[model samples]
Target: MKLKLIFLLTASILAFTGCNNFETLNTDPARSSETQPEFLLGNAEKRASDLLYDTYFNGRIGMELSQYWMGTDKTSDGRFLFTNDGLWSGMYAGPLMDLQEIQNYYDRHPEETNPNILAVSEILKSWIFHILTDVYVDIPYTQALKGDVIPQPVFDKGKDVYSALLVSLKKQIDVLSNPGTMAIRGDVVANGSAAQWVRIANALRMRIAMRMADAQPAEAKAIIEDAVKNTMVSVAQDAFFPYNVATVTNRFPYNDVDRPLVEFAVTSTLVTYLQSVNDPRLPIFARPDETNGKYIGKVYGTEANAPTMIGLSKPGVMAYSGSAKGYMITYAEVAFLKAEAAARGMAVGSASAEELYKEAVTASMTQWGVTDAKVVATYLEGVPYKGGTWKNVIGTQKWLALYMQGIQSWMERLRLDPKKPNGEVLFIPPASGSLDPEVTDVPKRLKYPSSSRAANAINSEQAAKSIGGDTQATKNWWDTL
Candidate 1:
């Protein structure tokens, strides 16, 4: 008993002593205090993919605007009634924030920064900002992502933003050309390959330059000439977000089991056009109607006289296989851009406009798993290039190639034919009866979020005015036509 009492008293004293420095002794060795740029880069990529490939934003809002698909149960988006505030806030607070953090880290620790990683970050940031300015017309670019430093960043003009982005992309191309020793880590899109990043950077520069072709002709011409001299993405090196079937979070948006399948159906406009041209991608794009043994698409945005859902074709099953790749940009699109540049008499190599156009169509067919040469030839013959109508031909083909990639398709429409000239516009507007009285045609840009207006009313109003009242019908700077 006496020995037991002494032992207990000694242990109590030791425990009291240990408590004095318990925090230092109990620290987790594996825990990291610093931000991991690698993990953050992957996260930023995923978030951007999610925003772009999301069922609501890309499908209902963008695809509907481009007339690729129409909402069945929910017709608001199809009617151009969507506010798109969530998309705006999501981009700024989500992926953009993550990317900004990565850049900020590198800027602060210049000694530890890798040129390859920095180049990758800049490329992605440009792409995201490209989408933003294209959608909103003008956004807080210069002072954006500064967190509390500039709470109410003034909205920059779309044209100015484009200029800055082009310069930044040019700088990145140089950085990537002579990459540093540090390897990119946690990369899900390009797998940490600097070669692939270089191609993407060059491709983006060309795309941006081409967008400014009409508005800033001389400058755009110079940029395109330089970009064409550099290496661009090949068909095998196309950028895509690879979704997996392992979990709800990783699965393709269309394949999300939690969401109902009957919310949308393929648009009749797309189905009819494909059928008219006898395009081989039709079957891959949509499934035959259930009641009728035919590919019958639903008329776009018709609520009063809307057809029953029983005989309407839904999007194809292959597209929602739970692992469909979320395409960011494709070789076909780049080829089409080259074709356009050539058509415009810009120096885009020795390939003629006709040859480039055919190549683009072939690339697009191949991308959609339709590589049969005879079928593609037949389709190309049906839609042969017309020198006098190169704009319509290229615009129409590009629109078709960008199916299901709604935002890109819609943006391309604005760029190609903002005025929606008769027989020239690439997109089909909603049925006359279905058209919302508030907007006369398909939306060209999304309005600023209400939250933005409420929180930063001065800046929001200034941006709205800068973009010509922030109405859906307002044209972006790139939509010069």
Candidate 2:
């Protein structure tokens, strides 16, 4: 059944060649339109996870932008020239389209519609849209997924899209909150647990709220307060997609023989911070530098005199292993969100900012296998919250905890220090010399893909104008001081 489902999902995704005609092409007679909701849901989950893992989370640009890893090649991603073609297509043509198909199925067979399936689909849809808007800003939202019905969907403003997504998430939460006779199936991420789905929904809500902190303070505060009251309160509830080496296609993208060894190494920013604090996860995160037998990172974006691969730390097993889980959102991130909210004097939960911050650190350590009680305690004592402003303290630790999840790490860094031309406060290594003179700073957002421009030219142009300009340096609505 699982194999059959995977096949159907793959077939469905392949049927849609372009975003402009996804809906029409997806419903062709040759395609398996009779695919079950469970299968569609499972496929959407896997494809979405893979896109995040392969195209964004583990992608070179994201890692380099977040300063988690540096490219050893002369054409290092540190130069900041990038496009969003893979991401835009993956979300729209794969997960989002599959989700819409599932919705269509339920609509046609209303009696057979499982609330659990529908709710999960909605949650996944919200997640993909969140990534889309956060990365590109002002994307096609309400009118998208209609195919021939609305071939040229107008782009929605980033803030308006965010507002709509929060509402959609709430409706999904309501559906999941109520009991239903049918059980959720084909749930590779959360194992068909409605309770876990609820937690994920709430955790995602908290994330969106935090993103809106500077731009939409009152709304952010209210949403976060409610989210904290209901979200995942511990490490066990993290939403992660587990990969199976047995399934060749499902293996981690970086687990290949050549890529891990040749292309990547840990960045100086990450290694320096971990070493400064005597972080135990250093060994776990990176292999010892081959030449010196000590962990060392290559300077990010430097061209002339960068460290050679042999002298720098390569990604450890956790990063490059086929079995490494694709983390969607984690308990550690939730704790930090609550900590940040508390620091902002928002009513999140009973825990104080210091208390939540400590828990977040512990959760991150525990996730990375630093579980010894005494060791964790000692580490916590060393990094305890001091007196004054909590911004740097929370921001720096959050950056460390969100190592492999580069997309989120980039988003958090932008949120913490939005106005800075260079991320000086967050310790993001600046790009220089090799960087294009036209590119004055690290990109605030990705440019609309060439595919998007060709397929939906008018709408894309409007989107760019709405967000100030279409350039990478153009800041999104939420990325404000």
Candidate 3:
């Protein structure tokens, strides 16, 4: 099933590439062209969701790095044995290309173009690029997606990329805020709701702004303040793709029948922390140990030498099901961002940091379907903000709330401890003897893929030189402590 899905996605890419001159192809009787902006938008949406959810989130590499789960193998991701090839390819060849095609379609038919479709395309483009830049730091931005026009695109500085993305997101919001006929036919995520799109755009801006908190404080403050005033105000406004079991393209990839039953185990770092705080979200996050009928989590990076897995907890069915929704950005995340802003003396709505923090936690609980009032109330009472160490407190809870959305969680961990002497944050523990001796700590950024080296050698070499070196230890502009 997974292979079939991959074939279909690959075929879609071929179809788009084969009809590069879509306008001319549209007039030819023998060639089929995707001239409709709605179709292009739909395809872009699905491709983006698949890359973000299936390739990144569901892949569990980020989860292992973030210490949310532990692998059972010796050379597993818990020991930092992973690569960014899947992510690099998915972002560049799949969604990024499709989004660029949407822009190309808009450029060809300016008068006939739907404003909402163009706006959504811009939002998604920013979304995919944001993920790309966050993970790899420096990436092709200005000259990216130009195909033959600029086959060897130079990598832009991470900060410059963020600046450009912020400008793009703001433009999308301005276009979406006004009253117009939103093209909803191909929008699987928000159903073409202009209001929802605006909310998502603002939320995305907030996320990018927070990513710049350490490196670009003034800009981050301004962008975050504006986002707080305009972004998703409630859980109902969260941007997410609802996966359906019947839709092969939209189904969660981890739900495949051939997948291993014990592919991942709840990490001791996560379960122990939750248990210490008596977090009600634990049972919802992981199944009880089969042997002791209690929650048991394995130590990170020690899965290979760990004792029998008869009692270890695995991720629950809902956590890895085909019907699980893929979140682009959520109100809870926005709330937490606002909380952090408030803690930093930035005005984010009428609520104080404590108020926003509690609200964020509740919103996350609600999103996970944990509606028991007592359970929520108890958890809240147990984990109230202690006033000091705001970064650690908020960062820890945010990490917990961002389960399954692994990449974002890892990014947050980075932001929280941008320049730690040891690359460990609140929820993610320090790397011990699990990693290779040469790897001193958690990686700051991914090396450029081998494909980039072979295909775009000159530009790739320039990028590597500009960003220190093409190694995991090289820190991006935003990694400044």
Best by TM-score: 1
Per-residue lDDT tens digits for candidate 1, residues 1-481, read: 9999999999999999899979877887789666788888898898998888888898888888888788887787888888456888888998888888887887888887776777788789999999898888889899998867898889999999999999999898888787767798878889998878777877888888888888889998898888877655457878888888887788886774565477778888878877877878889999888887799887787663333567788888766678888887888898999999999999989999999999999998988898889989988988888767788889888988888788988888877762211254334557644355657667878889898898789999988987788788888887876
Candidate 3: tens digits of C-alpha lDDT, residues 433-455? 53533455566767788888899
Name the 10 consecutive residues with the lowest summed lDDT in model 2. Answer: 418-427
lDDT of each: 0.82, 0.82, 0.78
lDDT-based ranking, best first?
1, 2, 3
Q: Which parts of model 3 have CA positions greater than 4 angstroms off?
A: 1-32, 55-58, 256-260, 303-309, 418-438
Cα TM-score of candidate 1: 0.91
TM-score of structure candidate 2: 0.89
Model 3's number of clashes is 0
For candidate 1, which ten residues in a row score worst on lDDT? 418-427
Query: If scored against the real structure, what TM-score would every candidate get?
Result: 0.91, 0.89, 0.88
Q: Record all residue pairs in model 3 with backbone atoms less than 3 Å apart, i.e. clashing.
A: none
Q: Candidate 3 — worst ten consecutive residues by lDDT sum?
A: 418-427
